[model samples]
Target: MRQYWVAPVGPFHTADGTAYATSITLTDVSPAPQITLPANMLEIGSEIELEASGFFSNTATPTLLLGFYLGGVAGVALAASTAVTTTTAAVAWPFQLRYRGVVRSIGAAGSIVGQGRLYLPTSLVASTTRFIPETAALRTVAIDTTVAKTVTVGAQWGTSSASNTLTCQDLSVRLVT
Candidate 1:
């Protein structure tokens, strides 16, 4: 039998008028939301899913980076998307990012393999959304499942400008066993 668990982290939404121009560990509400994976919480075939939505505006086209971390924004990287260059400037574009990973092993040598994708709007006037696929080859990450782990997501902008801002509107994490 399979069981599912929703991490008590978020549906975190950023407050209006709050945006970040530099790389940041995203937090809109008080205290950034994080998923706590307890020791031995994962077994072989266990899976995790992370989803987020946000808006971005740029003065000039800049490369955007999104990543998943084990502890916090500065922690060990589990997976990251390749830098994606924006196509438009001075326009508020909405984006959705999602990642799914499955545990391949457990114990001290526990590992998971995952991939992520980003959905970005090419134009506000047009009904087209650009699909930015994660370019990194899927690989196993060594995570010690015998100890508790914290997970977080972060965003970075290649160029810093007042007009170049990003805000995470929502984020959620889930686990399946």
Candidate 2:
């Protein structure tokens, strides 16, 4: 199976070009064109940025989960709101992640801001968590292409709330080493 993923716009180069092969093409569009990257193309020690925007309006409080995933697992917690009101929620997160053999280093930060109706009993809260292996044996290992992790942004409505729409307007990731 081909693992399709997103990438940044640039003439990027790695230490050894052989390990960093990409298929980049440009097409004419409106103001800006589009660029596509090969499937499952990611490198360690790369900096990534992701942003998601949408509107959420509801009559009652709702639970929402927003965060980033690496290696097919939730590595970083960008935002988590157990109780949220009707509002426009947006997530802007940036982080640097790298794995060297059995060790890893990461520095990340993000925010979940909202704007909702005034004078209503509304509340919005957010928290973050670092990605840690659940299994003890998995801790001392290397992240290869098969297990090569990619960056992902996500938001979920924890409950079946009425009159609630969380439209994810944009979800983008960029590599910056």
lDDT (0-100) at residue 38 of candidate 2?
Answer: 28
Residues 74-136 of candidate 1 have per-residue lDDT tens digits of 555576665668765747677777777889999987788887666766666442333323444
Using all chains and alpha carbons, the TM-scores for the candidates as numbered come to 0.77, 0.39
Off by over 4 Å in 2: 1-40, 70-151
- Winning candidate number (TM-score): 1
Clashing pairs in 1: none
User: What is model 2's C-alpha RMSD?
Assistant: 14.9
Task: Identify the leading candidate in terms of lDDT.
Answer: 1
Write down the worst ten-residue block by lDDT for model 1.
23-32
Report lDDT per candidate: 0.66, 0.31
